[model samples]
Target: MAHRYNLNVFCLPSELVDTLTPRALVGQPPPREPSPPPPTVAPLASAKGCNICLGATFADVDEQRVHFRTDWHRYNVKIRLSGGNAITESAFAQLVGGLEDSLSGSASSDDEISDESDAVNTLLSKINYTSLSDVPEDGTLKAPLTALTWFHSPPSTQIGVYRMLFPLDTPPSAYLSELKAMQATVEGGRKWAMFLVAGGHFAGAIVRVGRISDEQDEVVQTRKRKPPKSKPETEVLEHKTFHRYTTRKKQGGSQSINDNAKGAAISAGAMLRRYGEQALRDDIRNLLRDWAEDIHECERIFIRASVSNRRIFLDYEGCVISKGDGRLRTFPFPTRRPTQAELARCLQELVRAKVSHLTEEALRAQDEAYLASLPKPKPLPAQPALESVEKPKPPRLTKEEEIVREKWNRLLDMVSKGRLEPLKAFWEREGQDLGGIDALIPEWTGDRRASILQVAAQAGHDAVVQWLLFDLHADPTTPVPLAWTKDGGMESDASDAEAPPAGSRRTAYDLARSRAVRDVFRRCAADHPDWWDWFGIAHVPSALSKEKEEERDDKKKQRRKGLREKMREREAREREQERSSEVVFPVEEPPKAKKEPPSGPQKLGGSSGSTDGIAGLTPEMRAKVERERRARAAEARLR
Candidate 1:
């Protein structure tokens, strides 16, 4: 799939490619046709807040003005000046009424004062800490100038945002102005080099603009022009080369030779790739030298190449373009393999900026609409009268059920304590019908609501985990319940009701926390290759059977032993030759598969018509002669 070019996007159609990217704490774009605004709801009117009382909001300016004149406000001011929190209007009234003095004796004054201070402290703390997280006035969120302005979802990630960097400090108008100036350089016919090198295919060209649009736009950059109709000067210089075909992946799919590469072809292809890399580097270097004049006149150099492939143009052997070249810029989105036509497309794409903008309210609306489009979560299932709705406990337990629960609890404890012996004994005593093991099925626990398999795994009990997996037939695919928030939702950006949860949510396999436990799981999974959903657990299970691996190891050992013996024999031969004054002999190679003709056949030099010697030959002799002829014929075909 093509990489998303506009990630903070709501919807960035081709028509809106010029839509101005939003910047935080910056002025809005100049007025355009505004979409229908969200339902009007004026935010609460806030003033500097009463300085003495620390009041936050009021009905209007009139009420705020009246608030300062109130006796309680003045009294609160005095209380603040005395190095303590101000009293509330109600508290001030109670103190002024002298109710404390009437109820108690002279000792009441100190008690009343202490109570007022305590009440004021409690009121001020709430006001001081409380602020709407979504409102810009609170300094948490930046207010959007237009309802359609948007912030990147993952505030830190800015993978495909346009030329403007994330956390952009400049306004859109100024950014567009800069872009306009750059576009003017193109319109004025300055040369720009575009390069796309990937998967052994390299296409690059220094070119001049053909068609230019005067209107600086929201998204649309330029209209497509027919290649034949366009002038030849559009591409001042061009170079393309294709060499490496070592991979099984579609051409230009990737630069790496992974397992998908054919084993038989890999040795030869590796050589080709090594040559291709150097050839590509040499070609680029020569091309740059040849096009020095054109390169010097180049306004900007646009390159689109993978990290490994790009170095030929930038770093290798004193590249023409320095790594820190100001003109250096990468294609901000995915591109097809380097080609003349693709280079043309890249030229058009460079001028366009694609991003959709929306305010927080707009985002909320979209999220709500998206949620509303989904099927609702099913309500909880009905339970017996003995079960509690809030806690969802098990039904009234019979003696057998009570015994089972006790045994289950004991098994849990045994797993936690690494008492696998007792755990196995208990399993046997309880009978081998482990289908009802709570962790194996969807049933977490009767009362504890815990996944016993997860408990075993996280305890670093590989033996226990294996026993549960193999002996008890526990399913590693079964999902464990995750901790939920108070709102009955998971703490994630998106939630899937159809499944338990999504994104980082895992099954029993994940609970294999330690290396030992994880290795145990891997080994068991390898053993029973097709027993579970291995992909869901992110494990590419190896064959549980190790026969192939063992065979390979044995062959390697035998080859090593043979080589060592041969080396020792050679050393002894060399030593004997040094001590003895005898002539040195040539080392003999091992005998080949083909056998030499018998001396009898070579000596019998006769014509085809000389059948007299063969006439008296016995059937066994004739058969032997025929076999020798056949072997020679077969050996000739091999040659």
Candidate 2:
């Protein structure tokens, strides 16, 4: 439907419109220009520039902010606040002076103060500082506070003040004087502090210089146990305190002061109270004099200082003296001299800084000089004279005895070589004087105690065996004489000419059975069966007998079998000859003739006197018989 529609404009309420629009747009005064961001202060001309976190420079506000927010900057800040980082004495003094100037300027100026300026003022007011020459004697500030003030100061000022306060090159005596002056200034029960700046660290002590006395015991009413009247029940004793000081930063880190400092301070103070200060000084002078004398006497001296413990160690020659903690530790000289200066240097370095210049050559020279100074050792006591001793001479053998020895050696040689003839000759020549062929050689004992028969068997000499068994008539059955069982269990005496000692032995059969002589035994058994039996072959071990029997049976069977085969071949040949003869000459039957009785004796031959007896025969019959005989011979030749 096409119909005319009326349009109505809707408007926001005046209150809503006002709330929606910002104040600046509504014609209200705009927020004042954001205060123009407070102009950034220009970096100072004398600024050493940040070496940490910010690098060499902070080029803009953003860079400066970034640097300050870094962890490196934060860690350095923490170190400064904790007093772990230190500055020179001069630097600290300068810082204090600068702070004083800043405070004065801020007070005199009419300019409004800012948060940073207020902070600077607060830090300045907290620090308690004075000139080195005009430090207050009764100042209440302690060393920790002083150290903290120094650490919190500007870096440049801290360095300058620290350098001025504790010069590194100051002598020990100067430091001591300064400490004494500081101690004198402390008031009430307050302690005096003095620090030595050495090796870039602060090491010193805090001392309560004035004397203090107190009564340790007071009068008391006893309840049950009472003191004896003689001993005095109520005692009033006054105790005096002297040389009471605590180490502030001896050495460094967590190390405490050694006992040497404590003992020296205590003893010196006590001596001063008891005998006056002059006496104490005199004792110190005397001690220093003695030390000087010792140093001069030493060939080489090592002066060492421990910065951490503020101790000194002296090593000279072979002696080691440790000076620390309130006591001096003196070690006895080492026996083995040091070969090089490195040992002393290492030892010095362990306890303190090394001050001696020593080397291997220098140490060697010093050691030589020290050794030369020592007294010469006494000569060793003369050794007692040894008594002369005479050894009994070996008895010289007689000519006869020498000859017997020679013959005996020769016999052994011949036996070993299996020379039957030579051995027999040697025996024959010495048989009478040697008592008998069976007489044992003195040297042939133990494993060598074999008889002639055994020796021959061992030599594998059949000829020697025969000679010994038959010609020499050696007792084959004789039991070998063992050295242990010889001559009725008595050791054989070589000097006894009548009867010789029997030696350790074995049997001839046992010797022959040895692999070295086995062949000889086998040959003997085969060549002389009768002799082998006579020699008691049956007495051999059953195992050996069975072996021999089996071997003999095998040989016999092989020989018989071979002979039977030869006989069969011969019969075959004979048969072949007969067959050939019959084929060559046929047998003819004689005409039947009247039987005639025998007269005297049958004629043995006919008139045909030829060996074939064909004189009475016809030519044809002779020829036939000759042919048969030739054929038989040809057959026999073929066989």
Candidate 3:
């Protein structure tokens, strides 16, 4: 029979062998052992500090820049010259360039790189780069981070140009080549991971190189830890390695100088341009809301003209977004942008509505003219500036008391008749030397002008509330009480509900009516009073009478007192009964009982028979009885 042998042979690419399988052999060797490859010097260019730091560090051949060296990463990189000389930037770059070119075949010079050119360098100047000793021994990094440095450059600018090196068992190419090969194998690797810098630059390629251990997989898979008695489901992993790689575009992602400027300008312009339509609409809605709020204080007409370029603009729907009540409202526009004809029609409708104030025949004629002119309205011309004239001096008050009066009058006038357009300007133009409302209206504190009140109510401005209530000392009941009125026969706004108890008056009807605040009216009545007049009166139940209300309160107090009294009585009765029924063992007989006891010796019967008669019958009997008694007494004494 012929001799039989089993053998296995395998061959892999140099890059694969460089990382996965060391040059050393395993198992049996061939009869002709291959000579050991020449010893190669580990490149200083490839050496990094500790292999634990997790950061994106690169090494670029063209830039001759290598980040994450043993010194730079672990300690610090200092350029030193021989004989106590200081090295220039050019010299330092030259040395770095020479080292880089020696390790990798690339054209680079010391003069090519500079701190000025590197944005990361600029940022790094502001931070203190932590030394290697500060870094934790384990790979995990703690936060918040103290500082970070990358070629002293910002990634948003001249970033991604430099590359980094980290010390590891395998050569850097082993990692790079493997990633490239995998990409070629899988869909040509079209997509890569990209990094975004604060300055806006993009760069780098990320790679996954290896799998986590089976032990790590178990730990990571568990939802929670097991009990101490039970077997552990997983083991802690010492290291995590990547198994895939990705490349990202390294340059040209940050904004240009001109682009930044243009963006800022556009943002500012939007603030002004967008307000044109909004301002007109807001002015109109404000008027309506104010009118609703101040109907009691004489109703006043409000009108505002919007000058655009110079022509008057119209606003169709200017509903309020925020009310003094802190409510928010939004108007729905057409789902799609409106057509020109639609916009024109809307404008014409507004014009017709306002023109009603004119005479009927005149209105008709005006309407025809307006309709005809609608197709082409004349544009407004810019106002001409008159020659500058000497400004007049403001009035001076001799008395401080008069000063307050003047201020009060001014605030009243502003609220009642001042145009909204000039209101803000007037406030600034006065060169007023007052602080807050004190400067505005020191004395007109009795009541806020209807105009201001209307504005406050419409705008839901609570500061106005303090000014009116506290500063003006406007009594709630002066005109219409601030409290809701729920008298004996009163009905709530919602008549279906019962009236408040005879004296439980606390509603805000007029305020609600003037402000058109519907919700407030309903709520205030429901909790404070029971009746409302908002709905027509139906026979609603009347609230309790004042006496009845008081009785209810008194009853509540009485019930609590009764409970306390009952508890006290129960405790006292228990103590008294225990004392009265307690069993008492007699230590000594009572005097009355002791005196009568000698007569009860006869026949031992109910202590009723005559003991003297029995004693006379026989001495022998007595002797026997005495002997028996002596014997019993002896026995008792012994026991």
Candidate 4:
């Protein structure tokens, strides 16, 4: 026997089977290679905890990446970076100081340093500085310090100094009390004042707040006094600031505080000496900074000092501290306090800047100067009045033209009514003498511009159309009027057809074809064909006629079939009713009529001389009589 193998029982070696099997099926897969532990991610350099997006921390690169993707974190980041968010008072000061230090440090070029020094020297030269001891204590310095004229003055004229006495030993609390008292005093009079202190200097701005009455107020008051009205009279008093005082600095010294005084003022002096000069300066600067921060004024004065050769140089610069970023920016020109002489210069500059400063004398002088510069007016030349002339009138139409117009109007009426005979008669008389059939009639002067042929075609007057085209030999190619062409010819119902040219003229043949006048124009290439050529007729016959006929036949056949079906249904219903009635009535036939012997033989009329009696009667009657006679004869024979 030959060696045999079982096909179904074929097997592989154990190792081969193991290699072919999936890892999940073959015990636990080789213990996984321990996954290498995820690589550590380091934190970004600028990463910080997000205070705005609560619970968001960016301690590492991965955390920062995740946080940046959040909408809340992104929004806050944008607002902060854009400088739209308000900063704290301390942050504002720090930011401004840091910017200034950066600017100063970055000025490494010689040109930049020289420009800054020159600017400072020029500014210092314009200021008239006075010792603080020279200022009087009776509020005499207040006028110059708070004068609006100084604000309007030129930068040069505004630069001046006056001495003011500040008791240095006065505690910050005392200063606060004095400010409160001043505010109370002003508030009682419906006035407002803002006190700002910065860099150890104090500045105050005052404005009188009150209401003004309009004409309506007087009317309302009178009405209230006269009667008690249903509706309360409303008096609208407009609140306004009648006067404003923008303060200027009056002190001109590095030490803003006074160290020597008598009696109670002695306490302030002793306190200053005890604190030491540097310590005292630091404390005063801190106090002023705090006051400025609290007041939050748009305009304020800042006093800063520079030391050279152990001597102090004090200056006052106007500062604008925006509430948003708390950034403090100084005015370009720094000025010292104003002196008596400087006050006069400030007033002069102020007058130049305002129109209200124009006094009556100044106005008179300006008027005189204007008059001198102007050209002298000359007297008008005398002239005599002239009479009016009449304008020429247009000439009217002659009697002949009027008659022609009447005849043309009659022709138009005939054309509109499709009266071919009347139109022909009219044309024969005046119409032919005037012009050709296509010639426009002067009386027919409207937008239609349609010739007689076009009107006939539109009215579907086939006879008139034929007469105008073939009989009269009128130009069938004459274009239709604009109005008709815009409507794609009066005969055309196809709204989507191409519009006629701007002149909107179309030939008579086109109009006829559009109107579907089949009799006048045969269904040929020249008429309306599927295809045509310049030489002659390209196609012999049109498929339109054949298609239409076939369609008609199909419709007729369908109608006949529908009628036959309806007839058959009606007959079936009638037969069913008859069967039911027969079953219910059970009708019996009437007694058969007696077959009486025919009453004698019927006489027949002669046919002229011949005796053909059967010829006189119809075949049916003769056959009936003959049958009766034969039956009688048969009966007799039977008897």
- How accurate locally is residue 179 in candidate 2, as Cα lDDT from 0 to 100? 27
Alpha-carbon RMSD to native, per candidate: 22.4, 51.4, 37.9, 46.7
lDDT of 3 by residue, 1-639 (tens): 111121000112233223331111112122233223323334357643222222223345422234332222211222111111122334334433423122221232344333243322321222222222222323222222211111111111110000111112434335344332322312111111111111211111112112222454456558557522422211111111111111112532222222444562254434443343345334434443553322222111111111221121122344322212111111112211223333333222221111012233443464455444433322222111111212355666579858756755575555445344444454465525444332222223554222333333333434443343334432222122222232322324544656554324432223322332333333333444533342223111333445655787899999999999999999999999988975432222112332545655544445433344334646766565556556777887999
Candidate 1 runs further than 4 Å off? 1-135, 138-173, 179-188, 210-266, 352-639
What TM-score against the true fold does each predicted structure earn? 0.31, 0.22, 0.16, 0.22
lDDT of 1 by residue, 1-639 (tens): 133552212123322334334344323222323223223334454533554553434677887776765556655654444333455555555554432122232223445545644433333332332222222322233342432233242222112335522123546446434433443323436567778777767787877643333343312334434323323324445555455443334554332434236432355655665566677767777877787677767767888876666767777665677787777766766799778888877665553334444565665566555544545433322212112222344567789867766666676678788898987787777634443555332243442224677678767888888888777767676555554332333556434444544434556666565777776676667777677765555342443346765786799999999999999999999999887954332322223465557665554563334344446768876666566656777887999
Clashes of each: 9, 36, 32, 8
**Which residue pairs in candidate 4 have backbone atoms (N, alpha carbon, C) closer than 3 angstroms, thus clashing?**
132-163, 160-336, 160-337, 161-337, 166-258, 168-258, 169-268, 480-506
**Model 4 bad stretches (over 4 Å):** 1-395, 441-444, 485-639
lDDT for model 2, on a 0 to 1 scale?
Answer: 0.39
Candidate 4 residue-wise lDDT at 480 = 56
Score candidate 2 by TM-score against the native: 0.22
Question: What would the per-residue lDDT of candidate 4 be over residues 284-379, giving only the tens digit for each residue?
Answer: 334435545333432223222233201211222322233232222222234343232332232222212221233334544654555445454332
> What do the candidate models score in CA lDDT, each in turn?
0.54, 0.39, 0.31, 0.39
Q: Which stretches of candidate 2 lie over 4 Å from their true place?
A: 1-392, 443-447, 483-505, 513-639
lDDT measured at residue 316 in model 1 versus the true structure, 0 to 100? 60
Instruction: Choose 2 or 3, whichever is better by TM-score.
Output: 2
What are the runs in model 3 whose C-alpha is more than 4 Å off? 1-531, 534-546, 588-639
lDDT of each residue in 283-335, candidate 2, tens digit only: 32344344443333322222222343233222223223333212222121221
Choose the strongest candidate by lDDT: 1
State the RMSD for candidate 1.
Answer: 22.4
Comparing 1 with 2 on lDDT, the higher-scoring candidate is 1
